[model samples]
Target chain A: MPAVHAEGLFKVFGRRPADAVRRLQDGASVADVRESGATPAVIDAGFSVEPGEIFVVMGLSGSGKSTLLRMLNGLLETTAGTVRVGDAELTALDAPALRRLRQERMSMVFQHFALFPHRSVLDNAAYALEVRGVDRATRRAKAREALALVGLDQWADQKPGQLSGGMKQRVGLARALAADTDLLLMDEAFSALDPLIRREMQDQLLELQASLGKTIVFITHDLNEAMRLGDRIAIMRDGRIVQIGTPDQILETPADDYVRQFLADVDRGRVFTAGHVMVPAPALVAPTAAPAQVLQTMRDTRAGSVLVGDGDGRVVGVATEDVVRTAVAAGASSLAGLPLLPAVDVRATTPLNDLLAAAAQDEVPVTVVDDDGRLAGVVPRGAVLAALGGVPRPAAQPPVALAEAEAVPPADETALITSGGIRG
Target chain B: MAESSDDSGLLPRIPVGEWVDTAFDWVTENFEPVLDAISTASGAGVDGLTDALLLPPAILLAALLALLGGVLRSVRFGIASLVGLLLLISMEMWEPAMQTLALILVATVIAVAIGIPVGIAAAKSSRVSAVVRPVLDFMQTMPALVYLIPAVTFFGIGVVSGVVMTIIFALPPGVRLTELGIRQVDGELVEAGHAFGSPPGKILRGVQLPLALPTIMAGVNQVIMLALSMAVIAGFVGAGGLGGLVVTSLSRLDLGLGVEAGLAVVILAIYLDRLTSAFGQQRRGFPSFLSRGGTVTTTAAASSRSVDAPVTGATDQNARPEPAR
Candidate 1:
């Protein structure tokens, strides 16, 4: 089962919630519902999180992303629908049971770092555990461990008022960490910090996530942060989810004009992965294939190079046209003996910025490999340039030949890309 | 002329005064044991504190006051307290001053004990707050002398009645401020407590109360000041203290004795007022003292400057000293 599963969740804010929900289900607009004295904050919102993935809910303020996040943890009750954390239905739990769930199964970090000003850093960090009725010594020890994890053990005795904003936020993170729950709900947790501090905190959270792998439901208005931290992001608008996908998928193919507009300012070079821009190789040749056949296949596919893969699709090497032609003249029976050009291989997950850096040094298309070292596709220099320039490749031919695509002048490429034409 | 005409054409006046008179009589008759029990408890508390204050050697009490002043605030406040106590001693009104202090202390303790829980309840529920607000307003606005009539009617003439009346006069600020303070605690902090799964009671104790403390202490300070101001009025009902001396001296038109006793009262008021206000300031984490050019402006010094003007003028003029008669 997923760590968190929310289905058909609707939250209506006002009296006569049932009436409002009926109107919403009957396809009434949010404004229409409001006219009748009810406001729908979240409508039919649903999503599930895997056990250890960072699932981010992204939107502008008042978009119901926060409301959705709160519903997942039962902080805000759902007017209609069910939320299950692990196998337990949150909406079905009684107050005591729900509190126990919050105490033992999930914890939240707030935007303002809601720490008690009167409490010592150590005590504030240990608060959740204290609420859970953990014994004092054990709670303190655990809190100390969490504080050390966040690099704040030295400030344990100091009051929260004595800490800087970054340090106070760390205490908030430590409090959630100390609870040792399986799920973490972070509501715009880093938005209050200065930009530099915010970046540092994001980096710290990423590092912690790497080591801990806790299921996190992160809410933010920042698309950059959502892209950096989310394994999958759900983009919300006006109480409805417009799109949910990996950062690269969202950047490459936004679900609608709203999502596209929402992503207009995103730095695609950092967000789009090699997998997003990589085209399938023009051709794949076997090691035992005749050189004549290899050359024929490359010409038929209008390709500069072909990847040599084993029967199971593992990439052994690249075979260029020049090598194939030389092999054919040399009377080589198999293409394996040809002096193939060296090529850079990168994982499909490599960002376009890194792909551009790798592609800059290589003449041939860079090979993209899956997690298991199987050939996935190739990212040509043209594809990188086109993607970075925001130029849309032809729809009929998904993978453009590098030589043909490179014919565009660098100045036109710069103008076309800088004009943000990729949306087309 | 017809419209303006007569009392005979108007509605009959409700006999509210007679109803109140009968109600008080009925309560006094039936709840005599309960009333007596309250009087005994209040009397014991007042007498015990009065004896304790008066039994200590004059120098020892002054030293202790100075020490308390220094520890809670600053050495300047300590020295000021020392001078004030010495002035009381020099006026030969030490015992009467102690009795007045005792009455204020007893009334304040009782007021706080009853006030805070009521305040918390008022803060927690809108209905309770709505009910409590009008009651508090009535308690505060009713003439301080009105409390004496009912207090004496129930407990008869004694220190108990005086203390009871002082408590009624002083209780409103304690309750009102406590409610305001608790209500004013940041909503986010309370939400954080709830989000962490702390029970409501724990949230109140651990989160709400601690944050509200400085404001509540300010309320306690107000209560003490109001009680001190009522001490003189309490003496009208035969409660013996500096107020009694002022009353006796005023009847005889003995200006010298009355002036001395009134000066003693002013000194005591300033001392207690300075101490309690400094405590409130200290709780808020402001640096309570500053040393400058051989004059230390302690927290109390700042407050004393603000309060001294009207009080000193009024006391200097009225200067009614009660006698031991």
Candidate 2:
């Protein structure tokens, strides 16, 4: 069962909300509300959130994202349609029921940190519980646990004024957590913060969500942030849901022009990791070595490159099966007789975005390796594109040349700079 | 019966028209003496002045000093005090100005005593604002002269009457502005109270009142200045300060006394204006310390010191973006 379900949710602010909503049902959009001289804030929106899942709603300002959030808690009574939290219909609940739900089932973290400047960090976190008349001892213990969860236990007594912006937001999160609600609603909670602080808070929420498993509905305008945190994202435009899908699905196939433009220049490779997609290396003996030994190493590790050790077990060279074929095709040296060529190696720990540019500019396949720098596998250009939710096209289509190929590496450059296609 | 034929015989050529014209000429010639005998009015008198001087001077002093302190609080307006001194000396009305100053001081003390509590009550209760709002409206719109008639009717025309009228005329702004200041306090701060599960009244005491005070005090400053202006007008009803001197001089057609007394009023007005204005600046000039009625008088404020501290941490250190709620 859905943790929260909102069906045909509508909010129209005007002297005649009913009339305006009727007009909306008759095919008048939010714009028509103005054309007919009324204010229609939310119109015909619908979505369901599963328990223990992170659902993100993304939109630019005035796209009704904030209004939709307000409606979830009955801060605004909807003009039309029904909303339910679990089996309890939120729209039908009276004030007391709604307040009970807010205190016990749904805890909200507002964008402004909403930390009381006068209260100590501990007290701010414990506010929601206190409002519900949770006994002081239980509230304090829970608040401390929540604070420690956010790594703010040390600063419990510090007032918001004394705390940093990020710390204050952590306190806000702790407050929400201390409520021990089933659903945590965050309304662009980090938008007011600076970028670096924003990133930190995002990580904290993700961490908290993983361990706590509370059903979460996070609202944000930044698509990258949505991609980072959302289990599923619903894009909103002009009071309407444009598209809703998993991040990969949305990135790969945007619903329409609006979304395509929104995702343009969106660096997908940053979100993709080598662990998800890498071609397993094929193993065989160099003509000079035993095939059995090569087969043993290849069976042990399914990576793309094999290391050739000297008589002293020191690495002499590395072999990637794809690279051997390429060298033979280029007629540089036949793979049949030439010792395995060590092209270039990178660790799996390196971020994928960097690998894209470096491999492309060098016009060579990069070898993936263990932390000890031993060759483990190789990642060709095709694997990078495939991991990015883009299907690898047929062999006839040449790989798109990496941008750095047209230019020479500057003298004072690191290998990652030349190899990694770090999208700006 | 005998005249008509007799007149014709006596003057043979004199007409009746000639007789009527001569009679109207006689009346016009005698018009001034007739009017002088009919109704009368007084030109100007010393009694009004004497009555004005007999009133109390304390209220006048309160108004004057509040203005003076308010203005002197701002160094940018340094010329006001010197200019006020010059005006007083040139008009030769120094003694009356001092008396007015004394009265203004006393009135301000009374206003503060009464207005702040009323403001606090209004801030705490909506019902209070409802009751106070209309009263404030009435107080603001009622004419200053009208206040004097009631003062005289109730208090019998003295310095006490002047104080009563000035307070009546000036008190509303204090109440209205104080309430406004309190209500405008950030809602977030109020919610903090809920977080503590503190009563609304307690929240008001701890959070709302302290933040609202600077603005309310500003309102008080305005009330004092207004009250000073009304104090002089109260002179007409026998509430004396420097107001009496001006009224007396005007009565005697002594331009010298009139000018000097007017100058004296201006001096007191300036001093009150400066002092009240200075206090207001000190409120907004720096980030005032958030002391809850703790007598937060910080001199030589540290201007524009860094209020923002950097958040330093590992990758997530700067995370202050309002998280989605």
Candidate 3:
């Protein structure tokens, strides 16, 4: 079963909420409900979070993303429909039962770090466990471990008032982790930090999620953040979800003009990976293939280069037409013996932004390799440039390239072939 | 009809004073048992506290108070307490000073005990807040002396009557500030408590109470100041203290005694004010013995030595980003 399944959820605020919900369910619009004096904060919202998935809800302020999250956790009761978390129907649970569910099964991290100023950092991290009635020694040990995960074990004795905004937010994350729940709901958990700190936090959360594998429903107004973190993102607008898709899918085929307009601000290079733009390997030849046969295959495909894979299907290197012709003239038996061009190979998950220099310098496309160095696909220089230019910049904001290029580390020569082309 | 319309012959006189007298008489006649029990209990409480305070040698008490003030507040306030207490002793007002202190202390403790829960309730519910607002207004706006009439009638002329009047006059700020404090706590923090599955009671105890304590302490300070002023007024009802001494000195035209008694009241006010306000300003992480309450204080230190400089340093450490790895 999916970890969380919410269906037909509606939360109306102001007077006569039930009646407003009835009107909403009867096909009245959010504006219509507002005109009638009851504000429809969330309207017929529904989705499921798969186990170990980062399901992000993305929207601007007042889009009811937060309201929908609260409904899933049973903090705000649904006026219209149901929410099932695991096997339990969360909408059916009473207040005490919901509290028990929140205690044992789900935990939340807040936007402003919501840490108690009076509590020590360790105590703040241990708060959720304390509320669960865990024994002090066990809870403290667990809290220390969680703080260590966030690299804050040394500051455990200090109060949160002494910590900076980033450190305070680490305490918030630690509190959620210490709960040891399978499900975590984070409402803009990184939005309060400075941009550099925000990116660092995003990297940390991704690294943490890799090992912990908790099901998380993260909420954010920043589409770029949603794109980076979400395995599948749901776009919300005016109390309704307008689209649900993976990052690449949303970029390639936005559901409506609203999503397209929102995507205008996204730096596509950081979000789109090699896997997103790579085409099938151009021409493949076994490493033992005769140089004559390699030349014949490259001519048949009208390709400039061909990938040479060994018995394991892992690309050894690329052989260009000139290299193959030279090898043929020199009477080499197999393409493996020929001097091959240095085609930079990268894992499919490498961000397109990281491949810019490699793609710009090499004549051959960047090879996409799987975990065992097996051939996957190839991202060409043109594909990388096309992907980066897919979205236009918003007129008022500066272009993202200048700042982002500065953020890239000095190129690593082994992984990136920045100077050479086809070795003549 | 024309005569009635004129200012001098407006209408039949309303018997507001008589009606109030009748109301007081009815309460006195009907609720005598409950009133008597309260009077006896509070009277004994005041007597026990006054005797205990007086039992300590004045010099010993002064030193102990000075040490407490020094450790909990700052060294400067501590020295001030020592000097002020000695001056009160030199003027021969030590006994009456202790008497006034006991009265104010008892009244403040009682006022705070009852006021906080009411304030929490008011903060939680608009109905309770609406009902409390005007009653607090009336309690605060009424003259401090007017409370003495019912106080004397209810408990009879003594320290009990004085304590009762002081409680009434001092109660409003305690309630108001407590409510304001709880109400002013960040809404996101409360939402966070609920999101973490804390019940309402736990949220109130663990989250609301600690955050609201500074404001509540401010309220307690207000209560103490108002009680000191009102306790002196209660002396007109024959409740013996420095107020009685001042009244006697006034009657006899003895300027020296009046000045001494007035000076003693000032010393008591300043001491209590500083001590309670210090509780509101006390920072966390101090030795448990030095800390007054569990809450964290945001105010800087009053002394020139700058004991709180480390706290500002801690904040600055995280304010800037770490250098690139």
lDDT, residue A294, candidate 1: 65
lDDT of 1 at B310: 36
- Ten residues in sequence with the least summed lDDT for candidate 3 chain B: B316-325
**Which run of 10 residues does model 2 chain A get worst, by summed lDDT?**
A415-424
Per TM-score, what order, best first?
3, 1, 2
Separate clash counts for every candidate: 8, 61, 0
Question: Over the stretch A33-92, how does candidate 2's per-residue lDDT look in tens digits?
Answer: 777667887778999999998999999999899889878877678899998998899899
Write down the TM-score of every candidate.
0.83, 0.60, 0.87
Residues A1-424, candidate 3: write the lDDT tens digits. Answer: 9999999988889989999998878888777888888998888888889999999999999999999999989888888899999999999998999999999999999999999988999999999999999999999999999999999999999999999999999999999999999999999999999999999999999999999999999999999999999999999999999999998789877999999999999989888888766654433566777888767755654556766666565667777789999989999998777777665888778899888888776457687777777666666565576679884323432222212322322212211221111221
* Residue-by-residue lDDT tens digits, candidate 1, A1-424: 9999988889999979889998899998888899988888999988899999999999999999888887877778899999999989999998889888888899989999999998999999999999999999999999999999999999999999999999999999999999999999999999999999999999999999999999999999999999989999999999998899998678778899999887778877877667666665433466888988767755654555666767675667767778889999999999887777665788767788877766775335577776677656666566677677666665843643333332323322222231221111
lDDT tens readout by residue for model 1, B234-277:
88888889889888888999999899888888877767766776
Comparing only chain B with the true structure, the TM-scores of all models are 0.87, 0.61, 0.86
Q: What is the interface RMSD of each candidate, in Å?
A: 1.1, 4.6, 0.7
Residue-pair clashes, model 3: 0
Every model's DockQ = 0.59, 0.09, 0.63
